[model samples]
Target: MMIHTEPGIIKRDGVYFCSSDSFTQDNLFYILWGAVYSLDSPYRVSRSYMDAFMLQYIVSGELNFVLRGKTFTAKANEAVLLNCREKNLYWADRQAVVKWFHFNGKNTLPLLNYIYERNGGTGLFKKNYTKKIEPYIDSILNEIHKKDSNVFSISHNIYSILCELSAPPAVLESPAEKTIREALSFIQSNYSKSISVNDIAAHVSLSTYYFTRLFSKYMHLSPHTYLLSTRLEAAKKILIYTFEDIETISLRTGFQSSSHFIRAFKKANNITPNNFRKVFYQKSID
Candidate 1:
């Protein structure tokens, strides 16, 4: 497609860059990109970043992932779904080779659900594992290679991979509690700045005292506690996605001062903001 090469990204021999066409694919529901990684490659998840969910397949050697305080290892011919909403570290062994597909679209959730349901409510590699699933994996790659906008070949491939991985749907079916949901929604949308319980309660048309009680009962904390989590999450995103400093981040995330931001971030995430960024960058090979 006459795509231009960019610095800082590893391009596979056969895979094409999709960033240029990403905007055109908004109607695309989701996007897919393929890449092969060599051993000794370290890919760290961005701090405070949330992925749409991903699938990884080991073509050869082995890969290790540290996710949410646990370690997962996948060997050749095996595939796994990378979970969402967590900062993670992934690395390939000295001899490892891997092919990964990053997929996200309108039917992404549905596709994952279908796979999980088909696999008896578990994720992939649960049964007697075999190396013969390569053909199925190849089928997905072939579909993505089509790169057609009229038909939904890419979506189907993502659906099939979800089937192979047996990914699960969200466990939270309904909103936890009315007040809590409102508060959470407020936090997510407005976390770029300081917010207060009174502001949230007013948005939901409830008194502060009553709303605070309801928030604690359902959310297990007062509104301020939820705000901290939301603000921290936003701060993490800023650190990873942007190159702004602590003062900027503090103001953007509603912290009254940089000192306040540092204290809160260390308490919640167990690392200073600068250290978090340093560790995250250290993980990325590029």
Candidate 2:
């Protein structure tokens, strides 16, 4: 990949090749590219898409990111995930330093999805998260700096970094939370089925009205919205990782019809499903 930087910026990039033996044991998670960048003047990057997941951590100063249609500012000790197969742009506000890694394998998407969902569907993670994962990134970079080709070592470090980032924050629940927890678990497990709030209420032995209120109180979303978001999330994963037709994906994600799925997806993502796939796939081909 080619990145254009302004005159005052400095960038050091490393690309890794895994050996056959390392590939056999740690093929599911590995790094493809890594870089450290420092900018003292205005700098910007525009890319249609990338074929691998990218994580950028800000060491100092600030960086601004625009993806799909959302803009985010990541300051010192902040990090962000740029999903594969999407149009995005990032630039230094004025001066910044960042460490970045590009990684992909069998387990990459799931980890990325976990991070995305945890951050409320936004790619930006909080500063404490950046602090936690920085050491793991440094370990990976150290291996590359020493010209170590031990793919297994690099892969392990990458997985460690992901594990650190994906660890869920602990939350204490009241004893009365059993119903909501069970309801949430059910939705997560059965979002691909033709299930409704009534069904969820019945499963939890509560009246629909009471159940809806309880769910809304604890989850900050009514059961209906939660189900819709769950289905949409599934559809997004399929859209990114599979080549199945839109109708097939819609059906598989429990949408009643393709048109409904398209409208719902557009409302959530600001882009139609076909256009999303087109932009991403076209960039991959190029």
Q: What global local distance difference test value does model 1 have? A: 0.64
Candidate 1 is scored at a TM of 0.42
Clash pairs for candidate 1: 29-105, 30-104, 30-105, 194-254
How much lDDT does each candidate structure score?
A: 0.64, 0.80
lDDT of 1 at 53: 63
Give residue 45's error in model 1 in angstroms.
5.2
Give the per-residue lDDT of model 2 (tens digit) for 2-53.
4655565765454444333455444656667677878765688878767878
Assess every candidate by TM-score.
0.42, 0.53
Error of 1 at 143 (Å): 4.1
Error of 2 at 208 (Å): 38
lDDT of 1 at 283: 78
| Model 1 superposed RMSD (Cα) | 22.9
Where is the poorest 10-residue window by lDDT in model 1? 1-10
